[model samples]
Target: MEPLNNDMSSIPDRDALPYRDCVGIAVFNRDGNVFIGRRKGSDDPERSADFDAPWQMPQGGIDKGEDPLRAALRELYEETNITAVSLLAEAPEWIYYDLPEDMLGKALKGKYRGQRQRWFAFAFTGDDSEIDVEAPGGGKFHAEFEAWRWERLSRTPGLIVPFKREAYEKVVEAFIDIPQRFTHV
Candidate 1:
């Protein structure tokens, strides 16, 4: 398998984009609010991470032979330091987004031109304190914001990449009622 770049340079390009498979997750809390993290200043270009990276959702790629649900749970732990050891993740459906015409990777320069992703929704059964942004492994966007909150289902606070907004809306719509909090994991 190829190494996952922090900037995703390994994926194919627009037009000729090769097949790149990945996954994303939208995690909701008991109040039906979504978890969105604000990134650090050093990591964002033009400091957009403060706005765009601000509390979107947790998502990552599926490893070879690894299931997407498992990948989602892994990403939850890796990125937000939120563990699913206590909560349950139901079977999630796959959703996808194609990179814009100008954004496809070089390898996929001529292909349908972008990434195909599967998205999932999980209600966090853990406490906010369970999330340790300082966790030891996994890639994290350096953009950081001291403020974090539970966003309502009907609300959208931005920070979500333009191309991914619709997917976030869809995932939140599907899994908003699972549970608010738990500690079994």
Candidate 2:
């Protein structure tokens, strides 16, 4: 991983870089609210522990030959213990977001300039008790979120880090038809 540099030597030209292939999961509850987590880790550019807007939905890199839907479900399960979900919708197009210059090659292990993500919206079918941010404690990933909540989709962009705001905004618009797809139970 490229270390976060104070020097500008490592920064790559924006248009000359590639975007990482990733998937973003937007898990919606029965009430039509979307799930977001308070990111953990200070000094982390993506999470920006010091920033007031530190919340984001579950997302992760798509492994080689993996199906996007499966990857979305896998990321959702790994980050939050909620597997009972019914696919609601998928974005009509992929969304891209660029990393701030400081994170151009430093974040995502310096692999890509930013993320080109496929977003999915799913309706939660399990009871709230089934969701757990903390699970398999001794595993590779402990907990990416310190807390979690379901919020109105319209407010998602405001809760996300500035760099990811455009992606979140697109996600919200892409899935704006969600509420009608799932009736509150």
Candidate 3:
């Protein structure tokens, strides 16, 4: 295998894969409740990284030519019908996590481990009723969260995939100054 260069021109061209680098926004309300969702078909609803199902913050793909902040905003509206929320704050750079090898297809396997994700923290400025994962292009292809709720954002890091844990820890630490960080937005 050859070294992969992030440089746009040096990379060899190939068909696109669905699993790409992305930005995941962890939006919360004023009540100290961090935003979370139930994956559509997740076998385990209350899954931890060590189990079958686990709750998580809102996140999505970072399309080419899109900055992580922009991607975070786009995914916010797309997944939750959250159109007018305020950007309380954001992480400095990108956070990455990889899909399990078994979950990959012929197309997804050739590239990076999984996704290089950036997580943004926001306060929900709109009504909670506005969250509608069914709006249009939603739901995970395999695992899906069954429900959503607001919880302490500080605990999110220990819950996601092992590789993503560090990113989770870093993001929450950066945004610690925000009051309650999760609550009525």
Candidate 4:
């Protein structure tokens, strides 16, 4: 009998795989802090290590033919249950990130190599009571986060998975001035 070969080289080239189209939202509160959520770890042991740094902004796949901005709004409400928000700014360009070699064929349902994201910054205008991580999207959508909190924008990159750090850094740069704008409003 032959043993199973669990080699990565046997898989297709990761660079050749397509990136998932997605939208990321930076929901800033009146204090200028951005929202972050601790991802709910998967039951798969092979993928458990991916949650080492689970905190992330609200993000999700973009529906076919959906406008990027609308997708951002929908993802925000679905993930955080907060509808009172106003657009602050948008990243000048899409940011791309590749999954780690080990995660390439294991993550994103073994479909996407990573994500190509359009990011938006929004000023959260509702109270804290509106935020619900346990049963987001009015319980219609699967809960992606187990807990959530407001964090400093500059610190986000360090809080997310290493493979997605660069993307988070770019998002921070693109919306760096947004928080300050709310200070005087």
Which candidate wins on TM-score? 4
Q: Model 4 — TM-score against the truth?
A: 0.90
Best by lDDT: 4
Residue-level lDDT tens digits of model 2 in 95-168: 99988877777888887889999999998999988777866123445688878999988899999988888989
Residue-level error in angstroms, candidate 2, position 169? 1.1
lDDT of 4 by residue, 1-185 (tens): 99888896768588689999999999999989999998875773222764578889999899999999999999988888889998888899999998878777777888888899999999998999999988887798778888999999999999988878999999999998887876854
What are the models' TM-scores? 0.65, 0.88, 0.69, 0.90
Sort by lDDT, best first: what order? 4, 2, 3, 1
Residue pairs whose backbone atoms clash in candidate 4: none
Report the C-alpha lDDT of model 1 over 38-128, residue by residue, as the tens digit.
5444544323432344455666667899987787777767677677443335435556666554444322324545456676666777788
lDDT of 3 by residue, 1-185 (tens): 99877786434243344347888887767675677775555333224345543557777777879888898887777666677677877777766555544444432445644666777778777787777665523453322344677767787776565545776787778777665533344
The C-alpha stretches of model 4 lying farther than 4 A from their native spots are 1-9, 42-47
Model 2 scores worst on lDDT over the 10 consecutive residues at 133-142
Candidate 1 local lDDT, residue 75: 70
Evaluated against the true structure, the overall lDDT of model 4 is 0.87
Lowest summed lDDT across 10 adjacent residues in model 1 is found at 136-145
